[model samples]
Target chain A: MKTLQNFLFELCGEQLPSGFERMSTGAKELLAPLVDECYTDRSGNIVGYRRAALANAKKVMVEAHLDEIGLMVTKIDDNGFLHFTNLAGFSPEILPATSVTVRGVRPLPGVVATLPPHLLSPEEQKKPLPMDKMVIDIGYSAARARELVRVGDPIVLRQSCADLLNHRVCGKALDNRAGVAVILNALNDLVKMPLPVNLYVVFSAGEEFNGFGARHAAWEIAPDEALVIDVTHGASAQTPKNKAFPLGGGVMIGVAPVLNGEVTACLLDLAARNQIPYGREAMSGRTGTNSDGIAVSRAGVPVGLASIPLRYMHSGCEVVDLADMQACSRLIGRYVMQGGAVHYE
Target chain B: MIDAIRELAGVSGVSGNERNISEYIKGQILPYVDKVYEDSLGNLVAVRRGEGSRVMLMAHMDQIGLVASFVDDKGFVRVAPVGHVDPKTTVGRPVVFENGETGVFICGSKEKKEPELKDCYVDIGAADRAEALRRVEIGQTASFLSNTFETGRKIVSGALDNRAGCYCLMETLRRVKNNSCELYAVFTVQEEVGLRGAKVSGFEIAPDVAIAVDVTLSGDHPDARETTAVLGGGAAVKICDRSAICSRGIIEDLENLAARRGIPVQRDVLASGGTDIGSVQLLGKGVQVGGVSIPVRYCHSAVEMADKNDIEAVIGLLTAYLEK
Candidate 1:
């Protein structure tokens, strides 16, 4: 029996950098068996459907972006050093002296160049080096570098998903992959019991670059109600109290104008009744997630955001707690079992 | 030599991040030399044993560029200039990170004063701090986004300043068949950052005579007339720069060797700027030093142009002197 940790790690390993989501064969394989019918949409979003027990059932969509933040090659220097740009934003600080894999004709190993502290001046040592000074050194000369990599080739931080102490998992691409795992876990349980509504599980693409994938998935499914599962900043000493949630604090239920009031109420009620730990995140305007895109799809959607607390988000070592993920899975499962029939007074 | 310079210009080794350039140089010089290895500061040192005085040939591998110093809330990356990057040249240019993440180097339009490093930022199309932090980090270095192209008699590209010097030494090492003097062809690191790499490698291999194969400022351009060196005039034999004065004996030897070999050459006397010769000259109890400078137009900027004939002269003169 494969655990949720195994599933999440496997999903995280899929190097599905934004705009390159079509290369997600392994992630699709892991998801195909858990649903009644699985297919990929035009935007490269992987959509799965599970039919309800009765006829004329309400459609409920659960979405998690499959795309991860990465880099793209912009130029190959004469000595075969690679110059690149960000696919999505990340801190410029963590990039220096880091190892990465250039997804070229074949995956090639490279390192981000950094000045050794000894080489830096006293004033320079206090300052951060600029991104333009950084170049990916693949140890190839110009002729050979051009043979292997072309401009626009995707590059990802070379990191492997690993289980840490206290059921915490760490690696690259865990931001929304962890969300995808929660949906998969819920599907595993809901498959055993008959669902009241037709469940639509969408592993979306292009959420990091833009919310186009989620918007496309929501438009196609046209779900009456939607639940978006993505990662939120996990509490760390570096983060402020309101800025981040605890890693083991279960799911973060987003409360914002973008989210449906009734749906948010029902999700909070379900977690309490099911004894699942959850925290509340209040967004004044846009949730800065697929929830914002999904909520405004077509006419409109009564959408809710359920986010797992993830630490060190968008870096090579994003951390998430398995217990929190399991709790999120159960809450979503219970929501489906109740059919998300939240009626407004 | 032109091909070598073009290839060397393609690798990014901004001061400290010199591994790629170092490794590329090692591969090229390895098969020809008796022994080749990298020193602690990432300098590629290749040697051919001989019975005469140890002649250390130095050329730095690093170039000038920018480093990510800070990231603002809106995903705009602030940069600190690495080496001697002119703020004027950096604006509106594209820069690429070591991880292959490229960004447009820009500055605040509202500032009326001349653009400074603090006012500039790299926009990688990141929406916010969190988004930018996902792909890049502070302290990661970036080099200018440019290509190596030849226009008629001149080859133009970024990093050509020292890469031209590197090519000359590489060609010299390749052509020199006999081991007369013990040769130390040291491709150094961090020359742009106060010649730090040369300082280390120079101390390690204290030679009887040292020669820095590097680029000198050319005065052929319309805006510049104060410089003594000119493009197409042949290799510039260094007399004096702000950093180090050439040894009288080495300068005479270089001039005599160039004249004997029928190689065209010019005298280089720069009012400012320095190269590996500056640091390597100070090594040991005391060492005699000079330089063979490839006269380059627009020394520090992208699109720095070097004459093919001058590059050939540098390679020829170095080969002739080494074979003697």
Candidate 2:
């Protein structure tokens, strides 16, 4: 668990395009010696691979989107309230009164602010907050605002991660950045296991915004099967038991119309064979990851979903356990090491 | 010959939106021109009743697409590209709206470098999506402001290549003046997409002597194709290429006319892409056809610099060679 936490921390600290240049340079260096070849796509999806010794061995793809929920600078109003558009689906209520750093040539610190309750009518105050009225106030004059920050600036949470109760680590972008770390760790393990299948560790972009990057990556890199590794909400005493999977219990492996049934069965069987703990996560349809694109691809690529359990999904502070993270990597690594053909539906 | 070329280049029109150009040809020879009308595809057709000459002079009215697609609720609109829009030129361009609402192409994310056409959209200072949809629809199109200015001697800049051909047919009608042979000059729509408009027009006209007038690449630009026929080389005679293969007999006729009348002409073969001649060649029982091309630089872009002298010579050659 200590080794797992340190590995995830190093991956999280890597200057990923989570609004940073030199993206994947550090992450690529960390995953370098393990994977035989690696490259980043135009859409910023990182691709690392492990080759099979045999010529006709099965090819497998395990994907994790590199993009996370963030803010795009839409406008800077004259009153100095910075207007923002959500890069992905985000609650305006969670945004206001939250700290965020505007990433630019020079990072600018600011706070998302909302219209004063005093200014709103009692009728308006009762209503759900509108994104339009919400703005980020960096406490600068209009001229200075124009001089300092331009539109289209990437905004990230200023909140640093913390170690929560129940052996879970909390962070600003654990929604799927934690999933990115799991793939890196899985690739790290494949270095020793020498999987019989050709394994591709993919990092998708724009999954937080639009699936444009994922759709393109699926088209360009068409693998036989795609396993999207993302973070699903974990259940707690406060969370409805049925609504979310449990935190630190085990990895949540998904089964659905989106994921191939045979492929997912192999996941469950792999977990059992390796004696790795995992929970069944029933996804109704279109698992909302790069899996969505790969499922309905040209001829449809068989897919599987392996999720890292996290609490407070889509918010600033999210939690993930290091034990589940390590178990998730091992389960996927073992599956690709011996997984076979999926029966066509 | 050049007047025909200039008429096509100088006319201002956008994709799915060519009125002035279509109307200009309508008055020139609407009487002798058979079945003159606009198609659902936005192509203008002028037919000279000829059983012998199944021909289509294909040219596009659309130069490039405008930034029309918008994102409403967030104040930006997804830009729908009307034609082959270069994303590099779009970053800070001032786009003109159909209702004259002006706005700049917003690069909403600095992390994104040189947005692809689909990645970029226009943000007209609309408060929201309802206001944006009120101004622009999902399928509206516009031009990047028609600009024709003097760059140097005989060298001119504007959207011409095919429009120049559109005008050539217009003037060619007057030049062919009283020819009894059949001719069809199709000022086509969406040629930028595929040689689509001409495909339909050629299927309709099916003349015997099918000939098209379009612009071709010139070797005049610095470090250009080594085998490029130079700028102002004369009316480009198309031998063969991807889009169309000119019949040897028709090719002989045009070259004989040029040689006999002392009209300077350059022989050309495009390495890639087929033209309307590809369509005209397969019309009906197969019309024997060729093409007269004007040498131009920077095709399919704004500032499609062309040689004015070469253009005029094409008009002269088209007018003189079209005798019945």
Docking class of 1: incorrect
**Residue B72, candidate 2: alpha-carbon lDDT:** 60
Residue-wise lDDT of candidate 1 within A179-294, one digit each (tens)? Answer: 88888888877667888889898898767765657776787678898998998899998999887999898888999999999899999999988899998998899999999978
- Writing each residue's lDDT as its tens digit, candidate 2 over B138-183 gives 6566555445665554545456756777666666776676655665
DockQ of 1: 0.01
For every model in order, the TM-score on chain A comes to 0.97, 0.89
Residue by residue across B102-219, what tens digits does model 1's lDDT show? 8998887655677876678899999999999888988999988777888999999877878888888888888887857999999988889898988888879978888999998887
Per DockQ, the best of the predicted structures is: 2
How many pairs collide in each candidate, listed in order?
49, 28
Model 1 chain A: weakest 10-residue lDDT segment is A83-92
Cα error of candidate 1 at position A183, Å: 0.9
